[model samples]
Target: MIKLFLPLCILFLMSGCKKSELEAVNSSPTVSADKAVEVAAYEVEAPTPPKEISQKLLPDVNQSAQPPITPKKIDTIAKKIIKNGNMKIQVGDIKKAQTQVGDILKKNNAYIQSEQFQNTDVDDNLDLVIRVPHKNFDALVNSFSDGVGSVLSKNISSDDVTEEYTDVSIKLANKKIYLEKYRDMLRSASTTKDMIEIQETIRELEDEIDLAEGRLRLIDDRVNYSTLNLSLYKEKVRSSATSKIGFGSRFADSVTQGWNSFMSFLLGIISLWPFLLIIPILIFLWRKWKSGRTKP
Candidate 1:
């Protein structure tokens, strides 16, 4: 009975020791888990870098660094231009130069619109306005400049008449259409009153068509020809004697002119009969008074 009791006591002591060791192991694991949780919270709460530094670390790709480029397009349309010119030149012989100018115009398929020859004591001048083919405008101007004489003045100008020409053309075309419509109306007329009205309308349309055609013709002429206004003059020649005169010649001419003027004055006074008689009576009275004074 004593041995059995002693064994039971030893068994009880071993069981108590085993239980204490198990509790200690469980407590150690709990402490370790709390430490791990604290470390995780500290890591999550740590401060981050400033926004500017973060932006510098990660660059954007949308912003371009190269310059923008531009390209040019070529034009392909031709412009319509009306040319005009004005010129003045000096020539040797007015008549000969006028003839030569006419010949040049004919050769260039041109015609004179107007011409005037003015001869004065000072100079002989020819003024001309010519209409020349547009294709020969430049060539004619160059030829006149080089072959005519010394140029005094030159002016060349251009106007854009394309718009005017197109407008006139469109009007002319519309008028022709109206003319055809009026003719058709005249054909469809059956009553005398209707016929008279249609005929009158046709006449009106015809007149309008004529006017439009006239305007078109004028435009065509202007477009096909270029206008040139020209003036040519002959230089006055100095007489050889005047050109060679010195001081002596000028003095002689002055004396001769003065003498001729005095003679002409005397002749004028003689022509006045009343003045002639009065002069003779005054001369006689003066002579008598002089003799009386001498006697006294």
Candidate 2:
């Protein structure tokens, strides 16, 4: 009986130890679950950083805030000048002068743009419009002045177009850039209305570009070639007989005066005919009166 009692006591102690271990294990899981719930609540209540929130909301703002692209710098340009001249010359012989002018033009690599000739009773005139290289303009003018004929009038004019050219060039370059950008936009366009607007803008830019290019071309042409207006004059010599009245003219004048005098005398005799009839009647009346008095 003592041995059985000792074993029962040992068993009871062992069972009690097992129950305590089980309770510890179950309580630990509940504590862990409660801590996890508290952590999740804290996470839900926290606010995001301001910078990170802005970045997420405005994704393209950084790109939009970037500065615009600048245009390319142009190199230093040369000066542009347009020159024109006007001259009038008198020569002894127009044909000879014209030949000399042709030779001079050949030497100077010049060409006549237009020519006009006029012949009047007293003088002959030749007008020429000449286009020559800028380098040879002065030489040609001197040659015509000294060798071709005597100068009556001379005028030379110069216009500076450097500023104008530079300004136009810059504007044209900018327009081209805008045109390319618009074309790209048109290609990527999604809406019909946007595409139509971009196309209209592109068309207008193209027209402006063309006009600017045309102006540049015209300016270049004037700068490259100089214009010269030349006039040649020749006076005709009159003969002595034509200049002065000759003996034949004087003889014809005398014959005309004699004929005029004879006609005047005949007209005077015809005017006296009416008075002649009245004179005869008065004479007859006077004779009758004198005879009556002598009879009384």
Candidate 3:
């Protein structure tokens, strides 16, 4: 029993020495964690800035800083106004007055748009529709009043088309811009479908542009030219050159009536020929009867 116990005590002493050696080898040197973190901090990269914060620090250099330019306002003087007028005058001689008015119009660079003449027992009336430049509108009306004859009626009208004109102008400009863009799109087109679509768009824009331009042209014409309606009249019965029947005309009228009456009487006698035959037969019978009575 003593021998067995001696060997077990030796093994136990060896195991304790091995355990102490392992503990000494596994243990690390004592150092503060704060000191270790500070030492290695410089080697690490800095934290990235937030997306919002970074944008504020550096702005885009290519962008413009100035404000956009604004368009100017249109003036009233530049507006379009259409003028119209109407006049009625009574003159001594319509033909002479018409000639005078025509001369006046020619002098003012005006022209007759339309004219009408009416014939009546009382008088011959003349109606004239004239188109003159706006500058000459009032002048032409005044000339008719002063030179043509007595002014019986006069009227003037003014129409403001500024808003409509401006609207058409703006629409025309927009269509022009759209047409340019569509043309560019057509140039860059790849597929047939894309080309056809762009071409159609361009055609539509061109049509719109044309329509707007036409409207603008009409407005310009209306504003540039003024319309005038003039009426002229002269009393035929009151005029010195009135129509009258003379002695010679009366003699000819009487002869024509007498001839017409004789022709009418001849036609009536020809239509009674059958009845006249029967009347002659009855007269013969009556004469024979009277002779027979005398014999009895």
Candidate 4:
């Protein structure tokens, strides 16, 4: 009986120990502290970094090992677009030739940007500047050459603008990016002067950039298509008075003019009959002849 009692006491002790451990687990909110520590370590492993610092750090190591890039010979960008063309026509009348030219322009869907008509002792000329769509430019030029009797002088110019255009584009892109930053700063700025300054700078840069881009586009268009310049002259036609008259034509005109002059003189004398009374003796004689050379 004593041995059995002792064994039961040991079992009771073990059971009590197990129950206390279970109670401790139930009471504690942070269970499995090792797993929690592992999760927390994972969470704290990474942190967000500033953009500039990140970029500096992440640049390729190989690129850093290489030498700096060297620039090659840069081409000149044109200040203005290259536009050149010309046309010459020989015709009996410059005015009549211009009408035909107008018709041709309409047919080709082109327009005359400017024109000047001139005539001197030598000949007649029409100087014109016409603009046609890029697609139809060549066709219109060909037609102009075909229509004209001769081509006087042809000149062309080219503007190489690759470098200037590229530089401006790069500068424009950088300016735009900087301007965005300025805008962000503006939103948070407290001072009116600072805001106005930023706005003015952005406006000026935008205008300059727009002008540069426009000039570049124009230059590109001109270089892509060549232009032809021309001068036009027409031989003068003169008709003499003798040439206008055919056989006996001069004689008939003279006779007609003389007859007209004689009739005009007779009408003038009749119209002065009332005023002739002032001329005493002559008027009296005229009155006698008018009244009596008929009466007696």
User: By TM-score, who's the top model here?
Assistant: 2
Q: Alpha carbon lDDT of residue 31, candidate 2?
A: 96
Segments of candidate 4 deviating more than 4 angstroms: 1-83, 157-163, 213-230, 237-296
RMSD to true structure for each model, in Å: 21.4, 16.4, 14.7, 19.2
lDDT of 1 by residue, 203-279 (tens): 88788778877876776677689999999988788778668989988999999999999999988977898977898
Which has the higher lDDT value, candidate number 1 or candidate number 2? Answer: 2
Model 4: number of backbone collisions: 7
Model 4 scores a C-alpha lDDT of: 0.72
> Which residue pairs of candidate 4 clash?
77-161, 85-228, 85-229, 86-229, 86-230, 88-232, 292-295
| Tens-place lDDT digits, model 2, residues 1-296 | 99999999999999999999999998999999999999999999888779868666875878589687899986987999999999999999999999999999999999999999999989999999999998999999999888887899999999999999999999999999999999999999999999999999999999999999999999998889999999999989998867898899989999999999999999998899989789999999999999999994
- Per model, state how many residue pairs clash: 0, 0, 0, 7
lDDT of 4 by residue, 69-109 (tens): 89997655445434456556566666666777778778877
Model 1 TM-score relative to the real fold: 0.51
Clashing residue pairs in candidate 2 are: none
Evaluated with lDDT, which candidate comes out highest?
Answer: 2
List where candidate 2 sits over 4 angstroms from the true fold.
1-73, 245-296
TM-score of 2: 0.57
Q: What is the C-alpha lDDT of each candidate?
A: 0.84, 0.94, 0.86, 0.72
If both were scored by TM-score, which would come out higher, candidate 2 or candidate 4? 2
lDDT of 3 by residue, 1-296 (tens): 99999999999999999999887766533344556777678547567789778756666662345365788976443779999888889999988998999899998899999999998988888999998999998888888878779998999999999988887777777789888988998999999999999998888888888888888888889899999998998877655444566888889999999999999999999999999899989999999999999994
- Give the worst 10-residue stretch by lDDT in candidate 3: 25-34
Model 3, residue pairs in steric clash: none
